[model samples]
Target chain A: MTVIRAALLGFGTVGQGVYEAIKTHQKRLQERLGKKVEIAGVLIRDLRKQRSLPKHILVTDNIEDILAIDDLDIIFEAIVGNEPCYTYLNQAIEKGCHIITANKAMFAQFGTKLLEKAKQHRVQVGFEATTAGGVPIIRTIEQLLQVNKIEKVEAILNGTSNFILSEMRKNKLSFPDALQLAQERGYAEADPTNDIEGIDAFYKLMILSELIYGGQPEWRTVEKQGIRTLTSEKVQLAEQKQKRYKQIASLTKKDGKVLASVKPILVNKAHPLYHVEDVDNAIKLETSLIGTFTLQGPGAGKLPTASAMVEDFIYVLEKDKSIKQQGEVVYS
Target chain B: MTVIRAALLGFGTVGQGVYEAIKTHQKRLQERLGKKVEIAGVLIRDLRKQRSLPKHILVTDNIEDILAIDDLDIIFEAIVGNEPCYTYLNQAIEKGCHIITANKAMFAQFGTKLLEKAKQHRVQVGFEATTAGGVPIIRTIEQLLQVNKIEKVEAILNGTSNFILSEMRKNKLSFPDALQLAQERGYAEADPTNDIEGIDAFYKLMILSELIYGGQPEWRTVEKQGIRTLTSEKVQLAEQKQKRYKQIASLTKKDGKVLASVKPILVNKAHPLYHVEDVDNAIKLETSLIGTFTLQGPGAGKLPTASAMVEDFIYVLEKDKSIKQQGEVVYS
Candidate 1:
């Protein structure tokens, strides 16, 4: 592997983070992977948008500019939503380019479709950033599944909702005031329905369920509630009972069906999820043989999310190396 | 790709667990790896030892009996100590066999040598079972190093010592009484000095340091104090202060040098390591980008330790596939 080229699909916070990480850690990346990682193009909405990058690095307003690159190996999608990004990812998969996506909105809805397309084209997909920002929860679960059956998965999947709940609990703020604080803290967007209404956690839980069971993110099956329904009084009541309110996304088997729910749950001091405060996310995976495995870390941030994508990039490269090793003889 | 053969180096608890898991999950192994797994032999200490294995699987007291077989691809070493077993592992590595061990005594001391030997022989050395049983702590750290620089690692790496401490804290028992109860509960062995004296945790922390900073486990540099120095009064004092006593193995960089230590520390409810109770291990790695990442799970058990070996076996087999894939073109 001499030089592997990649395209950035969106110049959002995570995209800027990816650019910065690649720029700063270029030497370490090359040293670890034994290959040069070249960012061939950055796709954004506006050509007039200013970004401080090297003159050699290309910034394009059109995805076709990146698609025209003859030897492109990866397309790292950081765009939000499902329409254009989904279409772009589908096209990238059809063209046999591996994908590293940060956008869970599109992935949560069209994950099965994208996975099928990738399988058909024999390409790899990396979605570690879609759930928890930098934590290796998904990859860890994949490894655990090789030996143990994961009986239950409980997680704090949305940073915004958790931040809101924590603010409401600590500051004794009303729901509206907590939302304002979250927005002020830059943890919540102006149109924060996706997080406050539990849709974001729902999507993450759906992706988790998809990985565990298969063909999931069935919106109809998931019981959905969010921090919007919780009040300061309710938080105070839970606190009085030696409890804390955390917006939890849980997946458990009930009556032979994998049931998923995104809601605010009261947890006591004994629970691992009890102390996971503010924007930090935690996941507890209960296994048959290994008992309970819990992981807690920074869930969503620019560097953290980009770092997750980098991990995915390395994972895809690793898989590619393995596949190409076989390709040297058997495939050829 | 037809049939890969493995030899179990001990018929103890973990070895038997490995044998049972391999036997039961044969179908899964075949489907996952696209190959058949065959246990060639089990090397035991006694020829008169009775076992329930099939007649086709040979039980031998001599290492040469199993090593003589040319097709042995893997040697899962579940033996206790270094002496003869370490020599046998070295010989096996020299013979171009992959080594998976549950013994940490020699590994902590001779790991660098073994790693260099494995590299020289182009074979892998899998030691997942040596530390933290089945918790994928090592694998997680390996992934974290991909994107972030680890700053500090705080862990409860020993199960037997943790069990004893928890028993003392919960049952209000003395250290000796707790040890007796732990042994009665089968958590500690007859000669539990390795665990009680902090040597076991020291070995685990050393391995972790070696992975991150390199050139480690210089035994003299580590500050070792085990549960032997802990008193029931100290436990009571911690309880009075709403804290718990935990035997923590920590590795951190001070003035650009990695410092390692194993000692009893007091932790409050806010800390992740505080509540990690009986027979459970936890590792909290503080990093530059991802903040604090923690993993907790059942640390030691027959099935759990065996599951770790199984994980190592699969890891070695996966790497072997890649190596064989390349070998098909170059080596042939």
Candidate 2:
């Protein structure tokens, strides 16, 4: 058994959760893998921020402090936005260090180039946490593509919007009231534009498109709509008709072209999406071999999202070791 | 690229689907895997029965014929029941052939022994299809165990029972009427004993337990209940309260001991599992790292079940090559 030293690229909620989960579930993780995993460094934007992180682990603002360290085997990028994340990941990949990123924005925008780079470097890049928190959608897609020709992927990829929509339908609350309630419950960020306006869902869908369908549809090609226009009356009307409104991000391939969109759709009571409510996310894949298969789980949160990152770290470690030994042999 | 010669142990629904999936998706599988996978032989119990099948493939009823084929790299056992499936799988393992099985009965009873045998033989056993059709629950559990501590797993593992319950709730039908309707719809078998009595869910739960927790709980130790005793009145009462009755198989570790059960439980509308309706199956796993993660999909059907078996076949092909090059060593 080899012990892999890991580094955190950001110390926000997800990063902190990763650290905490590693400490809390260390015994179980070790038992399962038959090895010890340790966090060697954390790259925070600010070094003086007061938090309950382990004092012994080094915290630094300089990326090179962590990146230049030869002992670090993998990097977990929980950093939001594109600039630093893209730079750090590219550098990490170039350094022959495996990567597990929770940064959907970077992947959504530059995933193709990054994946190509990783492949060129003969390293593994795990982005399971980027799409659906902890639902294992990436691995699921990888497995499904093996046995099925997936024609379409429809998902409620944004939890904040789903949470608000679910509350509006069940509690009969106005959109504003639901949004406010979501904020109070910490389900929605203060700005909430990314989630409520559907940008977050769009980003996730972009990643899914790349992973499942070979490449992403142009950002401009995706028809985007948010939950802001939805009224309480519309939700009630849908419910009266035994339906529910969901913020759906769907990508379909027709005539060798991929069409992607993020919009609010009315799901009848019979559909599985109708049952997906309140910060919960569900993905349905329509495939030639299996017909339709769906997976639902927490689309976002500190612990769940961190769990995904941890899973990605382990997967990357395992896959990276194999890639190192076998060289870059592309599988069919 | 090594071409893995594979054989089908049974030509049932899943076996046929595996055949068709391989034949139809040949180009795609080859493109992804970079290897040519060919079917060397197919084992069937009877050959006189009229069935749609390819002409060039060799078919035989004798297990000895399959076992004697030294060139066969893998055996996909789609046969149901314990007697022949178990015996053939053991033989295949002993003969250094990787096994991909869709039979849950054999796995539920003898997975540990078979897994140990496969380990000793340095071969792999793929059992992804034995759980929830094409939902990828087994792979998800494998990934979860890689990173997180799975504290509990609660699921509606049997689609036939779920379909019956959903029908009873939606149409206010009696249990018997719903069951009859299910039988008519081909969701329920004629006897429906295994599904309706919670035996099927129990078997699946055992498999999940083994995969996630590394061992199976005692079959008799799991507290069991079924939908057979669920009355329409109880269904109506639960619905009136905005709750749904779901046949849930819940597994948890308490006080360092495994606690498992399968029963019909009332789930509030807020719970993610509450929305899974009809014949669909949903699984919600609570882990220390990720709070609650749920996956839902077509639990059972000819194609979905077949899709799972095919996925396992592809996995065995991919992992076998990787494992052969590198030994079965865990990387941190």
For model 2, report DockQ.
0.57
User: Can you tell me the CAPRI class of model 1?
Assistant: medium
Ten-residue region with minimum lDDT total, candidate 2 chain A: A323-332
What does candidate 1's lDDT look like per residue over A1-332, in tens digits?
A: 48989999998899999888887778878988888999988889978877787787778887788888878899999998887999899888888899999888888888878888997888999999999898888899888888777899999988888888888888899999989988898999999999898898888888898898774635886789867778799998998898998888999876777788888888997788887878888899988767787888888999889989998999998897788777767766
Q: What lDDT tens digits, residue by residue, belong to model 1 across residues B1-332? A: 48889999999888998998888778878888888999999999988867888898878989999899868899999987778988999999989899999888888878889999998899999988888998888788888888788999999999999988888888889999999998898888899998998999999888888888875846797899988988888998899999998999999887878888999988997788987888899999898777788888888888888888887889888987787777777877
Task: Please give, for residues A72-143, the per-residue lDDT of candidate 2 as tens digits.
Answer: 778888998999789989999998888888988888998889889999988888889898897888888887
* lDDT string, candidate 2, B1-332, tens digits: 36768899788767887887778777877787787878878998888987666676677898888777757888888888999788888889989999988888889999889999999998999988889887888888777777677888889999999989988888999999999999998888888999999999999999988877677677778788988898999999989999988999998887767889999998897787887878888898887666677888888777888788777777776687788656523331
Candidate 2: residue B239 lDDT (0-100): 92
- Provide the lowest-lDDT 10-residue window in model 2 chain B: B323-332
Q: Chain A TM-score per candidate?
A: 0.97, 0.95
Model 2 residue runs over 4 Å out of place are A1-3, A28-35, A51-56, A328-332, B51-55, B328-332
> In candidate 2, residue B235 scores what lDDT?
94
Highest lDDT against the true fold, candidate: 1
